[model samples]
Target: MGVSKMTGKFLKVKCGKCKNEQVIFEKPADDVKCLVCGEVLAKSMGGKARLKAKVLEVVR
Candidate 1:
């Protein structure tokens, strides 16, 4: 599903390497990283971080 399409949610995405929290849309992404430590989040691609999608609850 798409993030913009998914309203009413705060997409709590977690970093794969540092376990940091980040918000993202459901459309998927690349180069997603931790806002705090600048860690390479998501999956690693030849040493670069690749984005991965995670589901979050939409709190109304």
Candidate 2:
């Protein structure tokens, strides 16, 4: 048996309005919003999210 590592991509973004940092999926099905502030971080565009804020890191 082999152990398979789960590989996934996530984006660490910061909210422009409230300066809140959050992690979201790169290709989100829906709009990604900030938990602290009611601001849209990324908007869903078919398959991927159109980032509306600054991206801090890319988690693998």
Candidate 3:
């Protein structure tokens, strides 16, 4: 069998409240929060995380 490319990815995001840059999963199991501030950056949507912050870059 051949290996297949995965769709899931890591993302670089900036917190809306604190403007803190953070790295998160595309599909988070739980709510992703800012490291600097206690603000929700991404909300788990059972699939792809619903981003509450600004997406800076998409990590491979």
Candidate 4:
């Protein structure tokens, strides 16, 4: 099997409501709501940047 070139690290972001920390991976998304308090925690950026894939969403 070939190794996936698209890889990134999960980041720990603070929850806006509960102020709790959470971990997330590089995926396509708008913003992750806080699981604890239902408040928007952090947005998942397309940190898995790949030159091959154009569908990859870039957060910033």
Candidate 5:
């Protein structure tokens, strides 16, 4: 069996400015910003979040 679509996971990313790590929703309703540098990490496009930086991992 494969993973269900209903079970969504979070995305782990690193800030390009300060290298701070954070977890964000795969499909964020709003823009995801870095807590340290306040840089835009992801942008909501009415569906999945558009990543602005490199993704570290996916948190299941």
Candidate 6:
């Protein structure tokens, strides 16, 4: 069998300012921030998250 796609997926992103790597939801309920440094990694735009950091990979 193959992996089926869901409604949302996890993303691996690196903070632009701190270069800190973190995993966040594609559609986050709230704004996502960097753990190491307080940086807006992803901004919650109601529906989908607006990515501020560089996306490293999409987690399956």
Q: Judged by TM-score, which candidate is best?
A: 6
lDDT of 2 by residue, 32-59 (tens): 8999987999999967789998999996
Candidate 1 lDDT over 19-58, as tens digits, reads 6667753333355556877764455353433456343443
Off by over 4 Å in 4: 1-6, 44-60
**Residue pairs in candidate 4 whose N, alpha carbon or C atoms collide under 3 angstroms:** none
Q: What are the lDDT scores of the predictions, listed in order?
A: 0.52, 0.85, 0.89, 0.49, 0.88, 0.91
In order of appearance, the predictions have TM-scores of 0.37, 0.82, 0.85, 0.47, 0.84, 0.86
- Which digits, one per residue and each the tens of the lDDT, describe model 6 over residues 1-60? 134755788899999998999999889999999999989999999878999999999987
How many clashes (backbone N, Cα, C below 3 Å) per candidate?
A: 1, 0, 0, 0, 0, 0
In model 6, what is the error at residue 54, expressed in angstroms? Answer: 0.3
What range of 10 consecutive residues in model 4 has the weakest lDDT sum?
49-58
Pitting candidate 1 against candidate 5, the one with the higher lDDT is 5
By TM-score, rank the candidates, best first: 6, 3, 5, 2, 4, 1
- What local lDDT does model 5 show for residue 2? 50
Looking at candidate 3, the ten consecutive residues that score lowest on lDDT are 1-10
**RMSD, one per candidate, in order:** 6.9, 3.9, 3.7, 9.8, 3.6, 3.0
* Candidate 4 lDDT by residue in tens digits, 6-58: 45544555665566666545453556665787765454455432221122233
Report lDDT (Cα) of residue 54, candidate 6.
97
**Clashes by residue pair, model 3:** none
| Overall local distance difference test of candidate 1 | 0.52
